[model samples]
Structures are given as C-alpha cells and as structure tokens.
Target: MARKAQTPDIGPFDRHSISLRVDHVRQLFQTLDPYPFTERDLDKDAEEFIVSWARELTGDGPIRIVIHLPAQEASSAEGRKLGNAVRRYFEERTRAVSLDLRECFRLGRLSLAIGASVLALCMLGAQALSQHSFPGSLQSFLTESLIILGWVANWRPMEILLYDWWPIARHRNLLRRLSVADVRIVAVSPDERSHPPH
Candidate 1:
C-alpha cells in the first residue's frame, strides 16, 4: 500500500513571511489611481508599493522595513515636506523605485468569497444534475449551465467587490515596516520548525 502524502503545517511566522508579487502590487495601483489622492491614500500606496518591491527585489523572502514620518496631512506644507523626506529616505535605502499602490485587501477578500461561493454552487448543481441524469430539455440545461459558468468566470472580479464592502481593509499604514531579510528565489522547502519540534 502506498503512503498518502502528508500536508505540511503552516505557522503564523511562515505565513507572515510570505511576500506579495510585483504584478499583484501593480494591479493594486491600477485600481487606486481612479480615486482622488489623499494623505491616507498616499500612505497606503507607499507602504504596499514598498512591500511589493521589497519582495520582488529580495526574491519573495521574509523582510521588514521601518518607516518613520510626521503625523500630518500631505496637503499641508509640513506634511508635504515630511512626505518628501520619507520618500528620499526610502529612495536611498531601498533598491527599487518608489511606486504607489494602495490597499486592495478588502477587494481581495471579497473576490475569494465570491469565487468560493460560485465554485460551491457550481459543484452542487453539477452533482445534482449528474445524479438525476440530464433532463432532455436543451433550453433548461443551457440556461442552468450558463448561470453556473457565468459565476465561475466572474470569480476574478470578486476581489473588487471585497474592496468596496470593507472600508477598513482599504486603509493601511503609511509607514510600513519589514525586518530580517532572507531572499528565496524559488519557493523554499518547508522549514522543519513548521511542525512542532518533537
């Protein structure tokens, strides 16, 4: 008898260490550009962009960066000055260009939920149809199949809806922090510590 493959345990630290992809950040930026820019918007964009760039440059490895800035609105002179100073600090400190990408976290969550629900519904319908045998009515089958397929196909857009529903998820700290850089060009082997040490 063949042994079934065991799924590895994932720890909080392991999950935290996961990095967002560059393309993902780019898409996020595209979404945010349509909205009017605000201090909060600038901050969120800065943090997400830095995090994404850091991941890309460091090869999707665990890292942390500390951001410091004055508490002021960017519309004000003091705020603008502080923002520029922080920008320069990052420009000098990090390897990649500063790109603004605001929070799409809520959108992402929504997208997941929508996709999951759609997939579940489709699976349920398929099972029902298979069990009962297809009814010979072409119109009914076509209509039902189209509805299921439409939801499945639209799963990609769930992310956008997620963003809209949740306001908090859209606002991220302007000053982001990352620490202890370790670059892994390819996915790393699961750390032995992933499981409780015997």
Candidate 2:
C-alpha cells in the first residue's frame, strides 16, 4: 500500500497558541546546554520545566501552556518582545513536575481497544471468506493476507498506546533495553546474512 502522509488532526488549539507554545519550549530548551540531549537529562529537564511552568501559569490548578513560534524570522522589535515574554514566563514558573498517570493509562487503553477492533474486523472478514466455499488455496491466501494486513494496521496504535503508558523517560529506558536485546540476539545468530552481523 502507498502510505499517505497523514495531516494530523490537531485538537482545539489554534495556530497562534501552538506557535506560542513552541516559542516557549524553544526558549526553555535554549536555557539548557546543547542539542541531541541524552534521555536522562531530557527527561529530568522536561519534567522539572513542565511542572514549574504549569504552576506558574495556572497557579496550583490544571494548566496548559500555549506558545507560538512564527515560521518567519523575527526581524521586528515586536517579535523579539513577544519571544522574550515567553522566555520570562518559563523562568518565573514553579519547579515541580507531575503527570496524571490515570489519564495516560486511559488514553493507552482507548488506543489498544481501537487497534483490537481493527484486528477483530480483519479476522471476521477472513472467517467469512473461508466459509463461502472458496477454493482451499485461495482461502488460505486470503486469510494469510488479511492477518498480515491486520497486524501491520495494528502496529501504529499499539505503539501509541505503549508510548502513553511509558511516557518519555520510561520509553527511553525501554528503547535502550530493547536495543541491547536486539544486539545480543544478532550477536548470537549463526547466519550473518539472515540476521546480519551485529
């Protein structure tokens, strides 16, 4: 299948708000050192910043920060002023990070349910085709193809669910562990071409 580039359905937020948030985050990140930050530092900094900034913006209640970053160069003094305002907002915020685990889990569960439904539909179609007195070879081919398609379809939703459950910090750790396991498996494989030399 030719994969179409999906235009993301951004919820509720307007371009201005998103731009503001991006500008804020960029300025916040700039306060830290270097690009391509490691997992540990990124996790720690993200948590600390989110918590502090949230508290400052919303004052001990649920808060969302909306930042705007213009695509064009900020040549005008007004643009620079707006950027500086975002920077100050981050600096003045509280220094705590908290995530609602329950909400994250709920989102994960919803994603899993959707993926399972898609897989279930694929299975049902295969079963229906099999019972229609089709030739044995054709039935087998259709069933196998449907199963493979279903598996591929489910992959992205499953990944999203996993990401929600793990969050950034935990996800990074999970990826590291998975990478190590992959390396070990490749090292132990006898066929260099089949498994490829690690």
Candidate 3:
C-alpha cells in the first residue's frame, strides 16, 4: 500500500479577540481618488484592512474580531448613511472573496478529473504494450516509459485535489469568519471600551 505524504496542520487560528476603534466613519471612508465611489473604490479599504489583519494572526484556533465605530452620528441622517455604507462595504467584499474561493475549488476538481483520466489511459496502454509480440527489449522499454508518463500525468491533479486545495479552503473559512465578525457602533463614551474578554 502506498502512503500519502503528511502535510502540516494549518488551522482556524486563535487570538485574544481584537478590537479597533473607528472614532469617525467619515475619516475611514475618505479616499484621495479623483473619482469618488467608482467601481475600484468599493470595498477597497475594508479588504485591505482584512488582508493586513489576517497577516498578523498567529494561533491555532478561531478568535473574535470586533470593529467599533462611533455611535454618535454627526447628525441622525448622516449617521444612518454612514452605518449603511460601512455595512455594504464589508458585504460586497465578502461576496467577492467567496465567489473566487468557489471558482478555485471548481477548477481544482476539474483538473483532478482530467489528470486521473489521462493517468488511467497511460497505465492501460503500458499493460497492452507489454502483452504484444513486439521485440522484447523495445516492448519492455515502452512499458517502462508509459508507466513513468502515467505517474507524471497523475502528479498535478493529486496535488491540486489533495494538498493545494486544503490551504485555500482554510483561507476561505477565515475570510468568511472575518467578514461576518461583530461590528459594533459604540457611543462616544469611555464606558464602551471596558469589556471583559470572552
């Protein structure tokens, strides 16, 4: 029986739940681009923050992420608008990453199927060639060559379906976790800052 190579366990990391205070939502959304609210601008800031945050993490289990924004709106109307904008930003970014992750999985599965098919065909050819009444030395050489090619063909699909996809799957889960994280709008008061860790 052939043994599969062991891969390191990359997992849902743990951390002392993190919190970031956004004193003013307007400051966070202000971008210097000449064109405001362009296609490129949507979710740009939020994704960047998430990616940078993901990089700093080092743990073995999941942790809570909290983003606290100012509860006191500049005005009631503006406050509502600002809150809506922030929520939409994270929602759009989450959708984009989720779609990409799904596509990656789909492509990996297709490649796996194709590679396995080719490997099987090559192996069958090797067996057929070995049984033919051709010159003995030439027949043996052809059989060896086919077997080698089959293994080569099998390599990528095996890696894609087995090894490569694991990390991507793990990353997708992390992104999802981050996206749906607790987003609280705290009033401009010191009492909001004091909370015991869970």
Write down the TM-score of every candidate. 0.27, 0.33, 0.60
Off by over 4 Å in 1: 1-102, 133-154, 157-198
The most accurate candidate by TM-score is 3
Ranking by TM-score: 3, 2, 1
Cα lDDT tens digits, model 3, 1-198, are: 011111222233235244445555445564664444322243355556655665566753454444454456533454445444544555666677677767777877887788778878989999898778776588888888988887887787677767776766666666655545544333444464354222
**Runs in model 3 lying further than 4 Å from the true structure:** 1-17, 21-27, 30-46, 54-84, 133-137, 186-198
Candidate 2 colliding pairs? 19-67, 19-68, 19-69, 20-67, 20-68, 21-67, 21-68, 52-94
TM-score of 1: 0.27
Model 2 earns a TM-score of 0.33
Report how far residue 136 has shifted in candidate 1, in Å: 2.5
Looking at candidate 1, what is the lDDT of residue 183?
23
| RMSD in Å for model 3 | 10.8
Model 2 residue 28 CA deviation (Å) reads 9.5
Worst 10 residues of 1 by lDDT: 1-10
Give the top-scoring candidate (lDDT). Answer: 3
Model 1, 154-192: lDDT tens digits are: 656664654443433222221222423322211222352
lDDT of 2 by residue, 1-198 (tens): 011111223443212111122222234343455433221122344435444333233222222233233333233343344434433333332111113445565666776787788789999999888787766588789988988888877786677666645554443332222222210000112242243211
